[model samples]
Target chain A: MKASYTRLAAVLLMALASVALAADNDNHQVTVTVNDINELAVTGGDITLIISSATAGQNPNQATDNTCGLEWTVNTTNKKITVATNQSSFAHTLKVQAASVSGGTAAAEVTISDTAQDLVTGVATTLGTCTLNYRATATAAQGTQSVAHTITFTITAAS
Target chain B: MKRILPTLAATAAIFLSSLGQAADVAILNGDVSLTITTAAAGQQPPAVTDETGQLEWTTLVTDAVKKIIAQTNLAGPSYTLSVRAVNISAGDGTGAGAVVLSTTPADLVVDIPSGIQPLDPGTCTLRYAASATVTGGAGTDNHSVTFTITDQ
Candidate 1:
């Protein structure tokens, strides 16, 4: 009887130790990754610039529109925005300048063509906004004809 | 001799049963990682999700109801992280909806019925979602997510 009591005590002690080691909680690692994000958009929709009348002796008064704006969100450093138009040849010359620029340096007014031109430079990791000023010029010699331009803005790595 | 043998056998059975009643829980799968890489222009980064992690638990306490709560170690994260329990099996437990994880403990699974025997573990799938915005910028948040099973 005494031996049985000893064995029982030993078993109970072992079981209690096992219970003490049992874990009621567990954990795992979770990594939330945010990759480099560069997002650009054109807001305020389509704009129209009509050159109705021109001052005497000079080219048609340049028609300008500042209704549209460009907004961008870049999470990477050393990025720039480029602008280009679809039409290689057009009747009127179109120029674009980034005005009231934030988070980047506005480039000089660029005469838009088929080749992409830098619209904004020195853009780092930040949210930026700029007003797009478009100017259209036409000489009286060029006949009056409607020309539609499909402009594209892109955010690319700075060279 | 017969009487002594029966007494030892009964004692052994009780000890084994007591050992099996201990509370335990574990994450069966490995850690979960989610990456966000795409978003519309001028919009917040799209939410990313991962469903590869799972939770397994065993509790034999028959006197009270049990539940699972979750928490994260990240205190001030620029982004948002949420988790939910789904596809529960082998137990009577209701999964909670998506709970945005933080330093505070939140209910992840509730109403876990007790009397779950050993070798018959309860399991549930873990779904995690992470989101960020352009204003949040780009960074990585390593969260040590903990799941605890306790009596409700």
Candidate 2:
């Protein structure tokens, strides 16, 4: 009877051990890869700026348009937006300024030329927007000539 | 002596039965991968999701209910990652909704009925979603997600 009792106790201990080991767990890996994203878009349709009239004895009135805006989404750091024109020389001057900026500092009004000029500065990882204020100025000595300029905007690493 | 022999046989049978009914859990699917590479201008990055992973579990504990919990190894990630159980098999377990993944264990599936004979396993599909904002920048987060079956 004593041997039987001892065997029963051992069996009960083994059963308890199995119960303790019952809880199970498993694992799997999850890899998330995020790529650098920089997206820029131009809102509104094509705009036409015309300098048609001026006050007496003054240069032709400047034609200004704020109907268009620039929007960008950047996920990296130390970036800025630059603007350039395809025309190297023209009779009239075209200037652009970034106003009502949301995510970056607006540079001074830039005279559009072949060389790229900074339009927005201190743009880092953020979503930003600004109104593209365009102004066209002509003098009486330069005469009246319609100049169609193709402007390009680029986002690049800040200097 | 005859009564002692019968008692030992009954005890041995009971122990063997308990040993055969141990709870177990396993992942049926392999590692999951997700990516976030696009977003609209002037907006945050869109969330991405993957639903190819699955989980299978078994339990026979009659006294207590069982649940499946999930946890990750990454802490202080720049982006947000969330998970949920979906397309659950017709069993005793119910799918839990989306839960943001973190180091602390959170319930992914709950109300698992126990005492299942023949060790019928409950299974469910796993869905993982990852998202980021423009300010969060870009990076990768590798997480070793663990799933455990424990008494509730």
For candidate 1, write residues A89-140 as lDDT tens digits: 8888899999999879999999999999999999876778999999998889
Candidate 2's DockQ: 0.47
For residues A30-131, write the lDDT of model 2, one tens digit per residue. Answer: 998889998888887688998899999888899999999999999999999999998888999899999999989999999989999999999989899999
Q: C-alpha displacement of B149 in model 2, angstroms?
A: 1.1
Collision pairs in model 1: none
Model 1 ranges with Cα > 4 A deviation: A1-22, A43-52, A66-68, A85-92, A99-108, A113-118, A121-131, A140-150, A157-159, B1-20, B88-91, B118-120
Q: What is the TM-score (0 to 1) of candidate 1? A: 0.74
**What's every prediction's RMSD, in angstroms?**
4.9, 4.5
lDDT by residue (B1-152, candidate 1, tens digit) is: 74876577677757665665656778977888999997776556779999999988777766377889999999998789999999988455888889999999999998888766557778889999999876677789999999998887
Interface RMSD of structure candidate 1 (Å):
4.1
Model 1 Cα displacement at A88 (Å)?
6.8
